[model samples]
Target chain A: MNNVYLRNSVRFILLILLQVLVLDNINFRGYLNPYIYIMFILLLPFETPDWFILVSSFLVGFGVDLFSNTMGMHTAASVFIGFCRPGVLRFISSTRDYEQGMTPSIRDLGISWFLKYSIIIVLLHHIVFFYLEVFSFHEFFYTFWRVIISTIFTVIFIVIGQYLFYKKK
Target chain B: MRQLFRFLFKYYFFFLFVLLEVFAFIMIANNNYYQGGRMLNTANQLTGSIYQSYNNIFDYFNLKETNRQLAAENALLHAQNENSYVKITNKLFKVQDTTYKQQYQYVDAKVISSSTGKRNNYLMLNKGFEQGVRNDMAVVSPIGIVGIVNGVSNNFCSVMSLLHSEMKITAKIKKNNYLGTVVWEGGSYKTGTLLDIPSHVVISKGDTVITSGHSLDFPEGIPIGTVSYFKINQGDNTYKINITFFTDYKKLDYVYIVRNLFKEEQLKMKGVQHE
Candidate 1:
């Protein structure tokens, strides 16, 4: 159990470094800046203390913000998603049906449920992230276009990363 | 009291969630006050070096095109100098060079990383503090102004590219000398808008806009863009002019960083006068 915590921490740090150092620099057509760092929050162990989840989420985002130079955009987005995670999980998988100590994975939640969950969270994160980045609705339509384009790219990258790294054997 | 404590314990996660969110909100609101860009300079330097390596690998592909553009620019400059020389000789046998030419120096830099199709686009240059690149220095390509340096590390600097919504440059009509502020409207990298131009100012499509030199950053007469469209607001006296930028920001490669030699002295004088 303690090993799980250690593994998660190591994974979190590695993901953050990869994001800031390599992935942040990858700008495909300028509109598809894929943020795979949010995977850390998505992959947290089930039944972990809520305080730890919130704090860790905040710290992860804050660390990214520190590296990316976008002060609080990522922090706010990550926290919002973090706050909504448990409710989203419960909505998809009823608490009564959820196996004790079973982490949420595609195998446990089914591909359909997992896809829906990932889409909702990724859209929410990207919307909040981009909106806060511009900080105004003066160009509301323009912001909407950006939100859609970025969300699609983010989802693609997240799904690819999950399959490559976290698929159960 | 025991029942209440149990109820609170059951929903402690909810409380924690709210607390974390509120803290995050505060950070977002006060983001501008913190000097986060400075801290990110270290990361910028590291990524910039990596980008430089990658840029070297890809530069070979564009060498022919880049060389062609350089040659064309050289020819244009040579022709202009020749025309000026002939006109000066015709007017006077021996010309006294009394006009004080703008004392501007430029540092050539490579664009290590750049993004154009974003709300807040930024470009990273291969030159940094060690190369005399500093915050707020104006960056330009052979065609026109690109952006101002936002942060600098030891070996690289990040520029707030002209395509960003936050970018506001002082520009004026080259024909009539009417000054206005040019800003990106958050969609097209090739286009921006000029605001605060009065209705009385005569503007036409294809009218060239150049830097007004109202600020110490960029010099006067640096080509910005050409007016693509102009229309008066329904109830307001200001005209909104759409401008097609001269530079293709997406294809940026080499750029020149303009260093203002008298910036510190000029700023000090202005500060003292205001005080």
Candidate 2:
């Protein structure tokens, strides 16, 4: 009914479509593929309800699992990041407070804060995702490289996407 | 009850996260045994149609390569056609009848979606039950064997590729006649490992591997790969051999689904014997 809600809804559809149709096709060396859909979860307003964040993250994860055949790896990773989100945000903005209706972007939260915020969350998400996908620590280094490399790629996409779509307050 | 309700109310978001994560864990556990669930897989009609629509546009770019592959295949088939048969004089009068009974039939399909960058890779084909693609059907490209059909919807099917961790393909070294199981470790879609061949079996680099015909999914002698490198485990009597698969999964587009006409009869008879 409201502007924010309308924008978020449109974002959800567009992100899902882009992820399943376009981004999923990018096979980079058969590994280190970037998952840009998680940016949708990353870009929600700072003050969005915690329950809404977790629930929507789970839903988006399931939606991604449907197209990618990942079972629930995406959902689990998304929910894990969603759980850590508030803590990370609190830790980052220990000094300045976030304004209402403001999304966490470079423009809204400065370059340094946005970098720290996105990096921690993206790394956490990738760790959860790669570990769950393997479900083993036997290939520790292999999974570790996958997590690190994919996290870098995912973070780059998320950052670029934020600048491209959202503007400064 | 009051204290519990207060605690629950206080940490409802955390609890919600836990609940959702548990659901994800359950789905993952189930998929640990099966690659994808029947309910959620993209093989279903709706997801399949979405991929089909995208692939409709995407296929045009690869049309030239696809046509060349098809044309090459057509030339091969033409060279081997019944019409190309030559009448040869035998000691007896007849050598033309029933030389090879049709053991396998093929249903042509296009890959609507395929992923090579996962522990378990899956391919979704545009053909399904309507096209006579049933579960466990063998999917092969013009270059080599691809995968086995895992699940099927009305218009699409999901294939558990040879590159999947859960997939164990029965393959044999063509030169040495040693059989082994092919399994994929995560990360690299370019190569896979063949397990269970005895150490004493003499093998060499570039030794061709083919399907063993042990499973109904594939016929005997389909090209699996060539041995890349191998080493015998010090403790065990078996050798772990690496294979470079013939099919380039990243470039896969068109595939033929092998539909066995006698599979039902064979399975039924086997069931009777077991019973």
- Interface RMSD in Å per candidate, to 1 decimal? 3.4, 1.7
Give stretches of model 2 more than 4 Å off: A167-169, B29-32, B35-40, B82-100, B200-202, B235-237, B268-275
lDDT of 2: 0.84
* Docking quality band of candidate 1, CAPRI definitions: acceptable
**Model 1 spans with C-alpha error above 4 angstroms:** A1-34, A45-52, A59-63, A94-108, A137-145, A160-169, B1-69, B80-94, B99-102, B200-202, B268-275
TM-score of chain B of 1: 0.84
lDDT of 1 by residue, B107-174 (tens): 99988777665578777788888999888899988888899888788888888888877778999999
Q: Which candidate leads in lDDT? A: 2
Q: lDDT for each of the candidates? A: 0.80, 0.84
The candidate that achieves the highest DockQ relative to the unseen native structure: 2
lDDT tens digits by residue: candidate 1, A1-169? 7788887899899888888756876656556667788888887878876678788889999888765657677888898888888888877774347667566666566666767887888888888888888788887877787778877787778777767776575
A50-161 per-residue lDDT for model 2 (tens digits): 9999999998888888888887899999999989999988887734676677787787777778888889999999899988887789888988988888888878887888
Q: Write out fnat for all predictions, comma-separated.
A: 0.43, 0.75
